[model samples]
Target: MASVQKISTCLWFDTEALEAAQFYTAIFKKASIGRITRYGKEGFEYHQKPEGSVMTVEFTLDGTPFLALNGGSIFKFSEAISFIIHCSDQDEVDYFWEKLTEEGDPAAQQCGWLKDKYGVSWQVIPVEMVDLLNDPDNEKSQKVMAAMLPMKKIDLATLKEVYVRG
Candidate 1:
């Protein structure tokens, strides 16, 4: 029997579906490409893409199922939607920030959010930040929020320092 994924996110790309899948799988642990579907002749009238070109790339990143579609350039990614990576510590945050932003636009980076080379937005944040932000003490949350606003990549230590000092 063929099992079905309960839900999966489909990422739209102009033609970097395969490339983006490979890039994401390489960066994340327990990630790998699953299947590659190419366009067929029958769809030429609508899709307009050459037959045999990549249509979709199915992949998993850290157990999260995703599909990268080589749709045309009619749409682009925006900061309105972003995937958040909760890191256990500073090192994890740094690693993801460095890798995701390696070829990404520096100007688009702000408040721990960055648009990767493929134009996908991601938020690399420390796991501790969640707890701090949700802390019942409004002062602590405000302090952490203040500390986080001015940074591109999150600084776990600095956030902790602010939370503790407050």
Candidate 2:
């Protein structure tokens, strides 16, 4: 028999995992709720708390697996790790930048990085960025990077201007 295969990305939240999951499902398409397992007697005994609390909640966003729990609100998501989104052109980059930054913190770069309202980090990068950065002249790439270091959504026009000036 062939084993079932599933790809998932786990997120750690400070007691807001469930709420974040709900928010993501609502914002994206092809999303829905899945299995929800409550805390059992064993867990309660171990944690010394009441039963029926959220032990785990599974859900799918755009067909992606996500698990949420009622873990105490202590830790939070930060910029140490982020999801990178590759875009085909400026339009795609702009669109994703607009949507992802709606309730997130924007960073300064040609490749975008933001922390969402739920504290999840994301990197929205244009597909052509590699070509621009891989120019034979390192000066061009350096200039582009420098110019992009202060922008939130990354203006492609500015990056191109920097590249041409080199």
Candidate 3:
């Protein structure tokens, strides 16, 4: 079936399209793998992928459509592009952080951002953080920012408390 979403994210992997799809589907509660296409001899000159090798795998993560392309290792994921997961509460933030941070790069983590094993970066954030950071009171906003800046994974409850006390 065709994806109804007008725009979708495409992840480039070095012969890990299928593997990545499976990995992601297992993590997300509302996830599924869809169409998987294989390469053909037509593009052998450019892609150089075997005719029967996986070309792309389409999958969905919590309702968001994605495509995992079996692109070569010529391009690697960078921190410049990252996905933000908007969580509802501290539990959600902690859960996602623990799961995604497994085998992720420790040096890449900062301000609730983490890099997965595949070098893909993600921000597991509590929605309340956004609201508190953007609060009308500059003092509260500054306090929230200060409390969040040092945390690799945000402590939402503490941030809220900081906002209130400020």
TM-score of each: 0.96, 0.74, 0.94
Q: List the residue pairs that clash in candidate 1.
A: none
Residue range 1-166, candidate 1, lDDT tens digits: 9887888899999999999999999999889999899999997988999999999999998889999999999999988889999899999999999999989999999889999998889999888888998899999999999989999999888999999999
Give per-residue lDDT, candidate 2, residue 21.
73
TM-score of 1: 0.96
**Which candidate, 1 or 3, has the higher TM-score?**
1
- Model 1: which ten-residue window has the lowest total lDDT? 1-10
lDDT of the structure predicted as candidate 2:
0.70
Best-fitting candidate, measured by lDDT? 3
Top candidate when judged by TM-score against the true structure: 1
Q: Give lDDT tens digits, candidate 2, residues 50-92.
A: 5876666777766567787666665666678777767778887
**lDDT minimum window of 10 residues, candidate 3:** 1-10
Pairs of colliding residues, candidate 3: none
Candidate order (lDDT): 3, 1, 2
1 or 2, greater by TM-score: 1
Off by over 4 Å in 3: 1-3
